[model samples]
Target: MVAVIAGPDEMVGRSLPFSELSDCPYVVLLGEPGSGKSTVFETAAKAASRSVTIARALRVSGGQHVESPLFVDALDEDRSEGSKKDKIFQLRDKMLSSSLECWRISCRVEDWRGAADLSALQAATTGAPIVVTQLQNLSVREQAKILTSRGALDPEGFIGQARRHGAASFLECPSSDKMGVLT
Candidate 1:
């Protein structure tokens, strides 16, 4: 049976049925260089502007717990692009594994060399709102593999695998949101 499509007002911008965004503790940002991943983060932050405290994990038992607002900007400038990727991934894993109470995350990957592997990890992981973007070109199949392999969203078969992933993924453009837009 075919169901009727609803309007945004009816659904309130919800595009997925099994959505768990309300309770999501984290948001994973993924994309290739110049894909506007940063822009999206800024836009989403602006959309849900609020200062919520978040806890950071510690290695030692009974260790000091760090707290900060829900906003997390893990982008790095001094380090090499590859190092930056590692930093984000490490932070992501830590946040996911710990009992931290974080609401939003903002990450950017300007390097595509390690994008596929990282994206796959993000998609497969549960309990978070993940956004992956890329400015580089890879076959649609490659993109699909990364998303599905990580368990983000699934397409029916091989054909479905040849598409994009995330709540939204797009090419970079001048219209992209600025960091201040979120502030």
Candidate 2:
């Protein structure tokens, strides 16, 4: 997956492989609804030698016993009626009280409240810089690769048809629903 550090100039920033972000102590991954944020979060959790859910991590007391990052996905999936700011502040308090050293949180770009949310989370950290990154749409080559891997009988033909139908953008971010239509 490709990503870039999110900021005012992010559109022109250089992109990097998502794997390179593991070294960051705090990361807030923002992506469109079907941009694979949850997939990436799950992949990281599986790849990490040691990892825990943020909820479980928060339950651990006595400070930083867990030596790995805590992974939190679907930050925007909360069904609570509370305001976003309230949720962020509650998460901040939990992180501070638990004294967790590392975290990776994923949320839909539309749901993210920008710097305010980042600032709240940053306050819980031990001065480690918080790096916010946004997931990028899949390049055409990447989309083709996925199609090939999935045993598409005619990946190029499908791509052409999608383009003709003005649905090519869906190819860049294939969610389950979108994939159903494409495949």
Candidate 3:
């Protein structure tokens, strides 16, 4: 998958492969619901050559010095009985106390209020740049590629039918269908 990354110094959106973000010390991945945020995080974690720490945001705690890559998934999936903002603050505090050199966090676009929520993580970085990346919708070509790889006999025909029926938007997001068929 690809994402549009905006760095601290540069607000201009630049699309890059998710794997290219390895150098970033801190990253916040924003995407719509069911936009494959967890899928992307899991893929990256699996592809990591070295040891990578993975955790859910709600279970994250401090005192562990993780110098390797860290992947925290599903910030919006917290089921704790408190405001999300409070959870964010608590998460920030935990991050602040931890010795994390590189970390990537994923949250739904709607729940990520703005830069204010990331103040604590930014502070924790201690001069390392914090990058925010938003996952983009899959292009028609990419969708077609996925369909073809999934054994679709006529990928273009399926896309054409979807477009004609005004259901093309669904093709932009990944689904959990085992057959990989659009239907």
lDDT of 2 by residue, 58-153 (tens): 433435444447777667765234443356666667677767788888787888888788788878888977777888877777777778777888
Q: What is the C-alpha RMSD of each candidate to the true structure, in Å?
A: 14.8, 4.1, 3.2
Decoy 2 TM-score against native: 0.76
Q: Against the true structure, what is each candidate's TM-score? A: 0.35, 0.76, 0.80
lDDT of 2: 0.69
Better of 1 and 2 by lDDT: 2
Off by over 4 Å in 2: 7-12, 49-67, 79-85, 174-183
Distance from true location, Cα of 166 in model 3, Å = 3.0
Candidate 1 C-alpha lDDT tens digits along 1-183: 001122123433343311234344444433445544444445555656644222122212233343422444434321244433344455445544544565344334543224443464363245443432222333344445444554645523433432244312321121222321111
Give the lDDT of residue 68 in candidate 2: 45
Candidate 1's TM-score reads 0.35
**Highest TM-score among the candidates is held by which one?**
3
lDDT of each: 0.37, 0.69, 0.70
Show the lowest summed lDDT stretch of 10 residues, model 3. 50-59
Question: What would the TM-score be for candidate 3 when compared with the true structure?
Answer: 0.80
| Residue-level error in angstroms, candidate 1, position 183 | 21
Error of 2 at 129 (Å): 1.2
